[model samples]
Target: MLLEGSTANAVGSQTLDLHRTCTKASQIFSSPGENFIQNKDTVKYGELIVLGYNGSLANGDKGRRRSRLALTKRLKANGVKPDVIHHISTPLVSKALSNKGHHSISYTLSRSHSVIVEYTHDASTDMFQIGRSTESMIDFVVTDTAPSGGGSGGSAQSTISRYACRVICQRSPPYTARIYAAGFDSSRNIFLGERAAKWRTPDGLMDGLTTNGVLVMHPTGGFSEDSSPGVWREISVCGNVYALRESRSAQQRGKLVENETNVLQDGSLIDLCGATLLWRTTEGLRRTPTLKQLEALRQEINAARPQCPVGFNTLAFPSLAQREVVEKKQPWVYSNCGHVHGYHDWGFRKEKGGVERECPMCRRVGPYVPLWLGCEAGLYLDAGRPTHAFCPCGHVCSERTVRYWSQILLPHGTHAFHAACPFCGTWLTGGHEQIKLIFQGPVD
Candidate 1:
């Protein structure tokens, strides 16, 4: 029997016969044969090329002719004459998709038969009608039998028109989701959850998720391979998927899901069965960074420092742990002004583009070198160890000068400090700024 639209007034009788022949060819199930339809007449040519696909249903190739005929008829029924409908080859499918246009439609049977059609004319109202009706009308008959859920025909029909706006705007991977599940928390405490929500592809086929709803949280306290009856409902809005919390379930006492429903954004966190989990997109995984990119990052960091490494600044004081042993550790401290400080506490006053390092306490410009500010002359006569600190660049000043600089410097650079080396132009900071170096001892 001919399909509903097969005899529509828009399509000629010859086209209908070709569709019938193709349907018969599909039933025969022979191996793929040579192109049977090569006429130059646009409508006839489209029919024959589509019919070639009917001979053998290799992989996802079955029901292709039917879908093509159905789509053409649908377009024609809606008053949009398809100037041409070529059977895009499997190898050239990606290329065809790349060159897609607003008024063009490219439907092919590959892994999952894909239909991408855009409506640019004023007849979009009819296009919308066809898109909506054909969503249920289109069916891929595999081995002369239609598969469950209409066999990707629904996926093809529903996705194109629904996402045509996004496609025109050139937005990629248009849909996203955010999830908060306590099972994802490292501390296992759902209450103390992620600060930001994660984003992910809104494809409903993620493991325990389905067409209807997702297994909100398995009573087992973690994501399970098996799905529970109903914890959350998946709603499709303008081709984007969202998970809505179902009030029917009793497991909804978490901090993340206080509202009836949460619109999943790239960083929206959700609560699942008392566990807080963040939903994130896998776009990063799809784009793996190459080794060359990593090497360039390292090179960029190294270039920030001066070419000559010698005159670089070093940690001025003993380690934080050994502050008590300052007398023994740093013997050449510049302490004529009684200022003392460690590397982390030191900084520079902001200048135009950078900062200038100087003794804030006594107004002294110093790479303070060889100014002994240590234990008084016979305080540790028998002490075998030294009692003064020295800079890595051998520029030592009073210990009081360095310590005083820290007190005045830290407050100026609240988040971080930036100071240039007096002898060299290398920038320094307490922790890892752009460049940092801690000195164990005076550079010999």
Candidate 2:
């Protein structure tokens, strides 16, 4: 299904843990902020900044130290204390950025919970890395010319470079809306709305979006004459969480209006031009639940109900007999034909392996899967086996199945990798970290 932001949010909230730690979904990445003083630069709040390679290394360690010292002075003037800094080796930074991927840098920052700044051994390049609004990180590489020397013993010339600083800010609730259109399914759902400074729609906004942003446009028509003033069109008002779906119904113009509000609830449904749009305000829809959270849910579900209500009776036993087998106490079920064998005189054929055995009556291959578990891989659980892992989408499976899905779903690019829950239809986009959480086992 092609996912509009509104529909995806509803599915996500319904499938995964709707109540989670608040995290930002929109990240702002840019070059260093403009300089405020003759030699000082300003830092913005909520930015975990990294100042890498602040000077030329023409004078070896002495020149490098001079550059760092100059950067320190500038930061002090700007009232920034970069105490949680991590110094990365130049070779590592080059290898990481050269690959044109975010995993290496994202892993570094998340694993350390700190910012990274690296100076090239040549002192000509500086690199900084930070987490994005999504479950990823952005890298900024700054390269400059080599420092030069003047007259008098070719003494090293002073090259002043400003360091970057970011003020940590508290995280607020995330606001995301998902819209769904006809012919869109769980596999094809992507945010499909135009981001506009005003009510103007880009010719290509409905064509497709390159990234996730606010989309505030009507589905099948141009600007309406009866729209509420200033709030006529759909708008994401509060941090993209709360939205205003405003329109005036003129029973004459065929314009229908319902559910009037500026705040977007967890799962709100909207109908526009035969298109069903579901609205939701969720935190980190692009991210998956942590392993700890998933395990806790599993524990809660298990503790609440110690055993499966259906128990062993629901399990299917393979019958190899060409004729139907009957038992008064225990009924026999055919694997291939699904014909339930009742109490009769004919004896049934027995199979060696449930999955490998074929049906004698229909001559069909093994119907090895069941309703509770979609695939044969999860058959072990039905056999009274204990499971150690569960997908963030809430599928309980063996650890091996989790590993297999992880390798299969590892992201190839920004939007290339994804996995869907067969039972719930919720798509997981947080990559291997999310998959790993699926297998990390419950907490102690």
Candidate 3:
């Protein structure tokens, strides 16, 4: 069965407050007239942030190709719903109908017989498309995220579909959003060839899955420090949920999960095979640390004057903008024992791989790497002080943030899943995914 719409009532006065907050935030990026006229009147559904990016893209966020996208109610809704179904025997008729400038999904049952489901515009909801496509129909253009030190060059082939998925959000209060498998192309159509996984539902409606499929994992609890990872499921073209296929590109579909729906939650994780996205509702964002709060936390840590035991030099986390370049007073860590120190070339244990270094303080030998503050505020579960760090790749954040990400098993490739650092797409290593850093204060 298809997913049902949310029956929750309007958020009442919180809606006005949310509108005001969204308006205030939009003003920073938009002109005064545009901010007041275009933004203030609109309702913000939520935001979709791609994992791995610290804050912005490598070249910086440009147009729709940014690291994050805000799904706001458009002036005119452009969402589409399945309207008419046609079974055409002629190839020309199928081709002609798809090119008619209307949204559609074409399922090729065979060479001669094909089922085409036409869609009509939905005035009550706004639609946003995401994919690797550069087409105008896609609101957010995402590319494959390469793991740090993996040496997977930018020229590497991407597994992400050109038109991967689409999100339709209700325009009314309590703006519920639902995600579907494939997105409409520039011609306003989604075509599932015979080789693709297409089937007829019990209601006699046609449904299909994309080549790589669109997978979603909603957090068991709300998007908070206490939240746990939920079961990952595949979403069909009609927004029905199902268990994961045996393989990503398998011809057969998994069993239907009647209880679960395609309705997105605050901490929903959308994996598009190549890249993963984190969904944060406006209410959830309020609980997370803002950029200003993160900067304050950085200042608070630096104020304590954390010192290196060996070098006797005070170490400080570099500004978020200067994170790439290792600062002279930057703090380094022995990932195994969590001893914070200043950069040193010595203590490299040649016996246990040159990358492993013996910590001078604790005598624990482990992977030694520089500590980088996690800058993406949206990824944080709370505004707690930055304390713990992820192992292997030392991206530091709140204890809750580190704990949350360390427990998440993000989809790595087609079939495998692994825990990765959200700030950098580095796979977590060691017995424990994170460590509580022991920072030495100024001895003076």
Write the residue-wise lDDT of candidate 3 on 72-163 in tens digits: 86766666656556666767767877777667779999998787776665567677788887777777888888775232225248889888
TM-score of each: 0.17, 0.19, 0.90
**Candidate 2 local distance difference test against the native:** 0.23
Positional deviation of 228 in candidate 2, in angstroms? 27
Candidate maximizing lDDT: 3
Off by over 4 Å in 3: 1-37, 149-156
Candidates 1 and 2 compared: the better one by TM-score is: 2
- Please report, as a residue range, the 10-residue window in candidate 3 with the lowest summed lDDT: 25-34
Clashes of each: 39, 24, 0
Number of clashing pairs, model 2? 24
396 Cα displacement, candidate 1 (Å): 29
Instruction: Give the higher-lDDT candidate: 1 or 3.
Output: 3
- Deviating ranges (above 4 Å) for candidate 2: 1-208, 211-444
